[model samples]
Target chain A: MELASSNYIETIGFIAAFLTTAAFLPQVFKTWKTKDVSGLSFSMLLMFFVGVFLWLVYGYYKESPSMIMANTITLGSAFLLIYFKITYRKK
Target chain B: MELASSNYIETIGFIAAFLTTAAFLPQVFKTWKTKDVSGLSFSMLLMFFVGVFLWLVYGYYKESPSMIMANTITLGSAFLLIYFKITYRKK
Candidate 1:
């Protein structure tokens, strides 16, 4: 019973991780397509990048596969946001 | 030793949680201040809301205080973003 319960919880974690991580993609895509980032904040991307990096480190230290995977994706998205902010800045 | 190690890991998680969750604030503040969201994707915010809500549920099921706190804060930020997007739409 305990094992089954743990598995269930893990499944929930994975689902949550996938959802949250994937959520950043549409913004990334829209930014690429529109080439507009006036609505996006640079400070937020920088802070988010650092935060995701910490989460990645936390995942590794804790040996959580889901956390690691989710954070990797999130980190990538955060980086892209930063890149977009820098490249798409209005002159 | 094992208990101490677990506590250390939890500390990391909390730190990661705090950073990741709080990272959204700058965007929220910027949006409110600028009243501009043309660069902010509506699809992303919609997806993010669902994801954060799921994370909150997962946190509750796992009894993770950090996750719960982080997701709750994130949810608020995500909601704010959504609200900003709706309110600041260009006519």
Candidate 2:
């Protein structure tokens, strides 16, 4: 029973991780394609980058495979957005 | 020894939670202040909302206080952003 319950929780975590991490892709694609960053908040991207980085560290220390996987992908996406925000800003 | 290490992990989680949740504020503020939806991706906001909502459910099932708190706040913010995107798009 306990094992089954834990498995259920892991499934939920995995789905949650997948959704949240994949959520950033559209923004990345839109920003990349449009190169219109007027609406993007620099501070938000910076803070999110730092926060996701911390989450990555937290996941590592917690030994959570899902958290680690989610945050790693999220960290990369956040980095890409940050780069987009800067690189496209002057154009 | 284990307790101390666990506490340290908790501290990291707490900070990560605070940062990730708080990171949405500037975007909210910028959107509210400028009423700019051009740079905001509707698809991204929608996906983020669903993802955060799922994270909330996962947090509840996992009994993770930090996860619950962070996702709750993020969910609210994501919802607000979506609202802004829809409401301001026609303007």
Candidate 3:
């Protein structure tokens, strides 16, 4: 729980968190580049979009910068996907 | 920001969240049933597992039960996938 540890191993979790999370950067980048979300899962994105929004609010309530920052980026990317989802919806 | 309003639309976010997230249940059940995760993405899981773990801690720090419960379940499911990833290592 003491992720604040000063040791290198202590930072592994943070590194893991960052690395794993940054993995989404590619998806975000590609999505931004193409603005194509036909392959993305609408149901999945819709669900997590709200979940992340709630978490963003929760983070605000708690005043945790780490949570706030991550969730914000997550929200942005998720919203983009959701927007594309709505845009490309079948008429 | 007012998720506690108790209106159906207010609850839509929660329901959307539950449904979209629960969408993973089928994959979890399938993986559990067959113990086959070859189709799952290891890099994706690893990235998400650590991300979810950090989120859990962040949720705990914030004393938000909603965040805690959801992230805990996500972490558990992600860990299972991670286990499968390590287990099925190409040795």
DockQ of each candidate's interface versus the true one?
0.53, 0.58, 0.21
Better of 1 and 3 by TM-score: 1
Q: Write the per-residue lDDT of candidate 2 for residues B1-91, one digit (tens) a residue.
A: 3433767877777788998888878878888999988777787678788878877887677666777888999998999999999999975
For model 3, residues A1-91, the per-residue Cα lDDT tens digits are: 6444334433443453475458566776776677666556777777677777775665455444655666677777788777767876656
Q: After superposition, how far is residue A37 of candidate 3 from its true place, in Å?
A: 4.4
lDDT of each: 0.78, 0.81, 0.62
lDDT of 2: 0.81
* Candidate 3 lDDT: 0.62
Best by TM-score: 2
- Rate residue A52 of model 3 by lDDT: 72
How is the predicted docking of candidate 1 categorized under the CAPRI scheme? medium
lDDT (10s digit) by residue, model 2, range A1-91: 3433767776777788888888777878888898988767888788888989887887777656778889999899889988988898974
Q: Could you give candidate 1's per-residue lDDT for residues B1-91 as a string of tens digits?
A: 3433667766767887877777777778888999988767788788788878877876676666777888899899989999989999998
Estimate the lDDT of model 1: 0.78
Model 2 chain B worst lDDT run, 10 consecutive residues = B1-10
Q: Residue B34: error of model 2 in Å?
A: 2.5
Candidates sorted on TM-score, descending: 2, 1, 3
Q: List the residue pairs that clash in candidate 3.
A: A20-B47
lDDT tens digits by residue: candidate 1, A1-91:
3433766766767887887777777878888888888777677677678878877776676555776888899888889888888998987
Candidate 2's C-alpha runs over 4 A off are: A1-4, A89-91, B1-4
**Candidate 3, backbone clash total:** 1
Chain B structural similarity as TM-score, candidate 1: 0.90
